[model samples]
Each structure stands twice: as C-alpha cells, then as structure tokens.
Target: MASNSYCESCSEEGKPIAAIRFCSDCEERLCKEKNRNDNINESEKLESAVYEEVKNWKNHIIKQINTVVEKLEIDLSNCKKKNLDQVRKDNAKISELYDSVKEKEQELKFLKEHGSNNQLYLKLRKQRKGIKDVVKRVSEMTMSYKRTLLKFEKKAEIDLNSMGSIFEVKEACDIQYKPVKLQQAQVQLVRVESLLTLKKVKTNQLNLSDRLCLSDIAVTADNTLCLCNYDYGVCEIYVYRTYLDDLTYSSTLHLPSEPYGISILTGTDKAVVTLPHKSYVQFINTEHLKLDKTIRVGEGWYGITTTGDYIVVSNTKEIRILKKMGEILGTLQ
Candidate 1:
C-alpha cells in the first residue's frame, strides 16, 4: 500500500498500471485497447426512471393548484354578480325619485301658470259687486211696482164712489126730475201698512247754511266726533253736541298747528294725531279735546293709527310705531 508504482488493472503493489476502466472497443479495462462499444442503452434506462418520477410529482402539484384556483374564481364571480345587482337596484331607485320630482314640478308649474289666489279674490269681489247691484235694482223695481198697484187701487175706489152717487133720470116728463150736479174727481192712495211706508220729511226746515270745513276729526268708540280748526294762526278744537248731524258746531277744547292725521285709541277716548310738518304725533283727550302728550316721529311723517298701546305712523317710506309719550319703538318698511 506504500509502494510508489502500482498495477494498472488490479492495482498490485510494485507494478505498472495500464488501464483504469474497461476499454469501449475490447469490452475490457485497458489503456491501449483499439475496439469501440456503445453503453448508451444503460444510461437511457436510468434517465427514463428519473424523468418518470419527476413527471408524477409535477402532475400531482398541478391538480391541487387547479382545484384552489377554481374555488377562488367562483367566489370572484359571485361577488361581481352581487355588486351588479346592487348597482341595478340603486339605478332603479334613482329613476323613480327623478320621476316623482318631475311630477311635482309639473303640478307646481300648472298652478303658477293658471291659478293665482290674488286673481281668485279679484274675481270673487267682482261677483259680489254684481250680486249687490242686482239686489239693489230688484229692490227699486219692487218699490215702483208696489207704488203703481196703490195708484190703481185708489182710482178704482174713486170710480166706485162716483157710481154710487149716479141715478137714472127721466129725459122728458110732465113733472121733471132733478139732475145731480157732478162733483170734481178726488182720489187718495191709502198704504196697505202704515208703519212699513217711509215718511218723506223736508230737510229745508233745518236751514243749515253755515259750511263746516273740519279736518282730522277724531271720533270715540261711541261715535262722538271732535276736531280742531286752524283759522288765522289760531288753533281751536271743537266737539259737536248732536253727532255732527247738520245741526251742531260746539266744541269742548282746542290745541295748536291743526294736527293732520288722527286715529282713535282702542276702547278709549284718547287719540293720536300726526303733525306732518313738525314730525311729531300728539296724543289728545277726546273728552276735552286738549293735548295730553307729544311724541317725535321719524322724518316726513304723513299718516297715523293706533293699536291699543302703541301708536303707528307712516313716515316717508316706512311705518313707525311709538309709545303714547312719543318714544320710537320700531320701524317697518
């Protein structure tokens, strides 16, 4: 085993070796063989076995992978179908809402185009006026008809009285019969109901010749009329005794610049009057017709009215509400 030289065929000690493997041509282990032989058949068998085992392993893995992929694909398809169905339902709901909105819009347009409450009120007012006019005309015609019937009845009564006074007289006889003298025809129309007939009185008996030029008359809840007169820079407030009925010119008290617009305080004898040039509303007592208080209004005051506690006045382009003592509370356009 420790020799430097060794046999080539058997690996003997102290011998020269010639061949390390069998020669291909001689089918023997040799370094100098000249013949050749093929060993491809044996290598092909080993390769075929290795390839078959690898093929079997690859087929098994492929079958398992295909099964997993099919399951995933089915899940994906179901998710897509659910999403599509949800989208379809949403679209249907949107379409229905759009149709409902369109219907409401059409109804509103029809009402705006053809029907207006203001126009309806105007039409109703016109119809009411027509009905009132017809009623008044019929009343007048009925009164005339009743008057005509009364006149006919009176003429018939006069004719009956004249017939009772008439008697046939002989035209020619030895003793002549006296002829009655014909009296003048007299007639009177007697009313069927004395109380229902209206009595006509002559208004000339009052002899009302003095012209009353009263403005800004303040009346109480009981219809007592009062006003101020501005003559020659003097102011005098007057109260009519007999309800200003073409017979009275008396007054209780008076105050200054002849206040312009007057309004009765609700449920009281107090009143508010606007002095436009002075830009103030003055509260006056209806019983005494004297100034009780004065309150400043806005600029360019023109008209006035009272709502119980507050006095309302129309300024230039707005309405102003104030307390009774002339404090500005609110303004409205």
Candidate 2:
C-alpha cells in the first residue's frame, strides 16, 4: 500500500493533491501545480532581489566615482593655481632683472662716455661685472623655471591617466560570486629568551699606506664588502671578503675623483658611486672590481639612489633625476 503525501501549501483544501516530488532546498513535498507556482514565485523573488542589489551597487559605485572625480578636479585646480602663481612670481623676478640690467647698462654708458676720473672708470668696471653676474643668475633661474613647468606637465599627465584607469575599472565592474577553496595557514614557532648572550668573535685590521678616509661602503650578496676610500692622495675602492670571523683584503681599484656616496643597483653586480666635487657617478662592476662607466650628474652630488631604470642624485640645492646613461630627466627643489 502506498501512502500519499499531501501538498504542504494547500493541505487544508478539500481536494488536496498528492505530492509527486520533494524540494531539498525548501524542505517540502509539493503537488505538481503547487510546486510549479512556488518555483515561479521563488524565481520572481530571486530576480527582484538581484535587481535591487545590482541597483544599490551601481548607485554606490556612482557615488564613489563622483567623489573621486570631484577630488581630482579640486586637486588639479589647486595645482594649476599654484603653478600659475609661481609663474607670475618668476615673471616678476625676470622683469625686475631686466629693469636692473637696463639701469646698470645706462649707468655704465654714462660713466664711460662722460666721466673722466679714474675712480669713475673703476666704478664702471665694477658695475659691468655686477651686470654679468646678474645675467648669469637670470639664465640659471630661467632654466630652473622651465624644469618646474615640465615636471608639472608630467604630473598632470600621470594624474589624467590614473583617472582614466579608474573610470575604465568602474565601467568594467561586474557582480560575480565564485566559490573559493581555503587552505589552512602554516605557522612556524620560534623560541624566545629574556636575555641574549653576545660574544666577540674575531677582528681584522686593514693595512693601507694612505689614511683611512672611508666615504661609502656596499656589501654584495656573497659577503664581499666594497669600501670607498675618499683620501685625496689615494682615491680608491677596496674590496674585502667578509669571512665568518675576519675580513680579508681581496682587491683595490683607484678612482679619479673622490667617491662621496655609494649604492648597489637592484639585481645587478654593479654599484654606483657619487663623486661630489667631480659632478659624476661611476658605475663599478663589483664582481670584476673595475669601473664600468661614468655618468655626469651635477655638482655637489652628496646622496644617490637607484630605482627601476633611473638614478636619483641629490645635490646641495636640488635633487636631480637621471637615466642610467646620465640624461637629466627632471630636478626637484
């Protein structure tokens, strides 16, 4: 004998139909008609829910995009205003220099043409020297201003590209859910102690003819230390193998200029050393212990660092960004 299961939804009806199938998700036995109606209703509910969620998400994204765009607009506007203000100030300075030079020229002409005293002639010579100095300073200032303008343009271009990427990402945003498999994290435990013991292992002395005036040092992956000796009489780079206990002198290479700062290039067997007074950085091959090439940076290159395909050197007044071959990209004051 087969026992019939009545539909859960319409069981109280006079003529309750027999349940033909069981829904695992709903945990109910339903008749054909009732099951069909429930499925249609469930699909409609799911569709409505999905539509509402997507609408909310879209609105949220729109709000975020608007906020970011507004911020970018404000930042760009501020930058423009600041650059314009600087340009105005520079122009005023240029005008002032022009006027001063013109006045000095008029004064010199008058003194040279009409004055007869030796003192007046000496004064004219001094005025001419002062005018030359002013002109040189003006030329330097103009170059600096041009560099600043170029930097601003580059920055603006980068910002615009970033904004475009953001918009592209927003447009490509699609709602998707995926099942992710998670693995247990592996953690290692290390022993900790309250007091640490320290002991002196070994010490080795460096024997050199010249005075020890070490300016910069760089260590290789193989425990080889390269030291720059900035002594005027003996400008040399010394390489030493750092053993477990002591250092052994490996090799020494002489440099033409005094090395001020040194930095190892990433993923390379080379180091860049800056010569402050000489206005150049020498690229030395650490493995071969020889000078590879030299790049003229600028005067007073005290600090140096390498990033990607560029080398950044710091002079006293400004930081100059250069390519590996010594092409000056930009300057930061």
Candidate 3:
C-alpha cells in the first residue's frame, strides 16, 4: 500500500477526503484511522530480514575460520607424532642391537679365555651376520622416517566477491521481488590429471619361501609395503622397505591362516586384513608391523576395504558392510 492517495469511498459521496493509504491488492482506498500509521510496516519487515542475513553471514565466517583452525591443529599434531614415533622406534632398535653386541662381547671374552679355534671361528661368523642385520635396519629407519615439519602458510590474496546486494523496492510491484541468492564459491584441491606416467623407481626381489602366493599388498605411513604371502595353508605378511632407492626386507607377520585381502585404515597406523581360513578380518599395526585386536566375522572373506569410518568386505556370494567394532550393517547378495 502507498500513502498520499485520495479515499475512493469518500470521493463517490461528494466528499474529497484525503486517503491515508491505498492497498495495491484489490485497489482498495482507505482514510485516516485513529492512532495508526501502517506506512513503515513493509520497511520494518525488510529491516528485520536484513538483520537476520547479517547474523547468518557472521555465523558462516566463523564456521570457515573454525575449519581452517582445525586443519592446522591436526597438521601440527601429526608432525609432532611422526617425529616422536620415529625416535622411539630408533631407540628400541639401537637398544636391541646393543644388547646383542654385549652378549657377543661376553661370548668373545669367554672364547678368548678357554674356547678352541673352531668355536671362535663360528662365533665370529655369527657376529658378522648380526652386525650386517643391525646396519641394514639402521639404514632403513633413516630413509623411511623422513621428518615432516608442519609450518603455517598464510594465504596472500583472497578475491571474495559480495555474497549479494540488498535491494530496495522503489515501486509497489517490486514487492514481489525475489532476494538474490549467495554466490557459491568452491575451493578445489589440485589433483593429478589423466595420462599419469608411472615408472618403477626401484625394483628388488624378495627372498620368498616355498609355495608363496602374493595375495594382497598395503603401503604404510612410514613408506613400507606389507605384502601378504600365502604359503601352502599358512600365511606370512612380509613388511618390505626401500631405503635410499635400495629395497630391503623389514620383518614378517606369521599369520595362523592364509590371509587374502588387505587395506590400510584411513588416517591411522593400522591395516585391516581379511583371512579367509580364519573366517575373520584382523587389524595389523603398520607402525610396528604386528597384529592388533580384530573383528571376528565368521566366513571365508575375500576382498576387504575401508571407508574412513566403516569396513567393507566381500566373499564368494555376498558383500558385507561392517563397522570397525564388528557391527554388521547390511549384506548384499
């Protein structure tokens, strides 16, 4: 309704009464009402709506800041964790090596006192083998545990356009105007395009056991590959590492049954493997390359994969969706 128009009801009766307002809908005209000024009603509604939008804008900015802060915090924590984990592993290996060397020292001392030439020769050969093993482990750790320091980087130019402009309706017909929507801005992470050329940087043979079938493979956070080797009815998960572009074998996980499928759980130092013979999926800690507690799902599980939060496994007939806690979600045949 617009103000300052003449009242149509009074004009028809030879009374030229000034109209207080006119209703755009139905073209109704009305004169003054006692103690009533409805002229600013539309403006007040628009003002309230604008205030609401401002509040929403503030909330949106806060959410964006929180997201960035959380990411930085996570990065900082992961950096510290990786450094500490590496140092701890190095200390453990060095300690073991020292203990073995000390035992050999004692053996050499006794051999020098009373042992014959044959005993001393055999002892020296075993000591040489131990020395070589220690050297290889030290070399592998130095390469795999490369320090990743998290540093904060500030963005230079943020070319953010307006969310939208607040429009005022000049004419009565403009009251039917739809508010302009906020322009969506998307931030895309740089991804590798097609035509990816992958050449084998290093390829060294594994001294595999008899009847070993290389079932599945998974790469760990420390840049080591755990290869599942099915030997006869038994299984051995070989943890292999390549240090300085030279391949070296780390350790082995001797499983009770023939392991088939394997996948590293996202954002963790653990891997979930499917052992069909045991009829369950087992969790393996990739950090130490050892078995963690597992979800004992009964069946001959074949393929396995994880979706950040849930674990998915498949067998001969059906596919089972499960949580890490062994909660079965659904089964599709």
Candidate 4:
C-alpha cells in the first residue's frame, strides 16, 4: 500500500493533519468509501434494453426460418400439380384403349357369326394386330413412368446459444489497482553488471567422421556443451568440457537420422534434441552420456526450447507448443 500524508479518519477537526501510520479499521473505511463508486440507478434500464435486443434477435431468426418454409411450400405445390397432371394423362390413355377393345370385341363376334372365310381371316388378323399395339403401348407407358420422392434434407440446424455470446464489458481503468515501481537494485537482481562487449578467448574444433553442420548447442549442469550436428546425412552429437581453457572432447553420439536442434533441461549431462525430418524428440541422458528415450511430439521438427511447463518447437513454417508428455497444446503460424 502507498503512503498518504493527509489523515482521512480525523478530517472532522476542521484542519488537516499528517497521517503517520493507518490502522486496519482506517484502511477498511477508506476502501469501503472507494467501493461506493458504482452507480446502480440505470441497471433497470440496461436490463430492459438487453431484453429488447434478445427479442429482436429471436424475431430475426424466426423470420428467416419462416421465409425458407414458405419457399418449400410453394415448391411442394408445384410438384403436386405436375404429378397429378401426368397421372391424369396416363388414365386418359388407358380409358381410350379400353373403349377400343370393347368395340373390337363386338366386331370380332359379328364377323365370326355372319362373315365368310376371307372376311373372318382378315378381321381376325387385324384384331390381333390392334391388340398387340395396345399391349405394347400399355407396357411402354408402365415402364417409362417414374415415381418421384421428396425428402426433407436438414443441411443445418439452429443452435440459439451458439449464435452469439454475452459477456461483461470491462472498460479501461474499471478495476482499482496500485502500480508498484521496481527500484533500480531490484531490477538487477539476476545480474550485477551488463555485458558490454565480446573478446576472443580460445577456439578449438572436434573432428568427426563426416561434414559438420552445427545446428544447435546447449550447456548442461555439468558445465559441458552438447552440440547437435547434421553430419553428412547422419545425426551426431558431440560433447565437450567447457570449464577448461582448452576444449576437451568428451564423447560422440551416433543417431540414425539427422539432428536439428538441442535444448538443455537441467543439464550438465541430460538434454533434449529434435530430429530433422522426424516426428519425435529424443531425450539426452548426459549423465549416462546416452539417449534415454524418445517421445513423438510432431512432424517436421526444426528448433526446440523448454519453457516452464511447455516445450515449444518450431519448423520453417510454424511452431508447435506441446506439453512434456507429447500432448499438443496449440500452434502458431
């Protein structure tokens, strides 16, 4: 809490007095006075306005649904008209064929009873031909006729709660807070002096079997440096002691795939490294100077770092933030 010179509790004396130290009750009284900043007089008006807005939204959605329903009804009416017309035409053709058959039957009976051999033969043949034509017409009509079926396809559904959201508006300076300024001494808690410049101290190189492309390096708790190198299509890690003035080679790790980057997680020995073009990360047991185990995090791993409870990995395209147990948290492009 910041100090105040004016006494808030003793202001009834008609003169101002400097407050040396405030008690708990005085602080509480001041806080209660400050808490009275809320003006609840317009709450009923706000409630009415919000209720009107909700009603408007509901009406708008219902109107859209009704419009769609009306359109569907019109289409259904047109479909019924078309289907009835086709059915009526089919019925008319069948009735005409029936009437013609009845007339032919009478002609066949009259010719059989009164006609000579030539007339009987010609009439019978013509009647058979007409019957065959009628049969063909009926068969064709039945085969060519199609039955149409209509279905109510629900392509979407309305979720009223998911349509929008309601939230409290917190404008600027709505919350009372005391801004604390850090002292200059507190600012430098991690470092006594700042780094000004760099100077060459010592330089040495470790020879490997193939070409070296130093991808990433990390310092372990053992005061050693583990360098991840992509060595001529092979993954290799070279360990070296950094406490000595001269670089001392410690050991080399051979991997089946090429390595991308390395990061330390409480090391002098143990570390983590990502494999290039691989979907997993290998844990380096620097104590045993060997790979402990591997966890499948993501694909196209390029660079990686351990921050608090998360392991952030990055490729050329995007970054994958993951938990320690290979759970994918999120991604950034």
Worst 10 residues of 1 by lDDT: 179-188
At residue 187, give the lDDT of candidate 3. Answer: 19
Residues 20-138, candidate 2: write the lDDT tens digits. 55544455555779757866997799778777876787788779879977987888888789888988988898898889888877876787788877857788778877877897987
How far residue 26's Cα lies from its native spot in candidate 3, in Å, is 56
Better of 1 and 2 by lDDT: 2
Task: At residue 22, give the lDDT of candidate 2.
Answer: 52
| Candidate 3 residue runs with Cα over 4 Å from true position | 1-197
Model 4 vs. true fold: TM: 0.46
**Where in model 2 is the C-alpha error above 4 Å?**
1-202
* Residue-by-residue lDDT tens digits, candidate 3, 21-76: 44444354556641133456756887999999988997897799799889989988
Q: How close is candidate 1 to the true structure, as a TM-score?
A: 0.33
Q: What is the lDDT of residue 73 in candidate 1?
A: 78
The residue-by-residue lDDT of candidate 4 on 63-168, one tens digit each, is 9989989999999899889889988988898899889988998887898899888898998887787889989998998899888776677656655555466677
> Top TM-score: which candidate number?
4
List TM-score per model, in order.
0.33, 0.40, 0.41, 0.46
Largest lDDT belongs to which candidate?
Answer: 3
Error of 2 at 167 (Å): 32
Taken over the whole model, the C-alpha lDDT of each candidate is 0.57, 0.74, 0.76, 0.72
Best-to-worst TM-score order: 4, 3, 2, 1
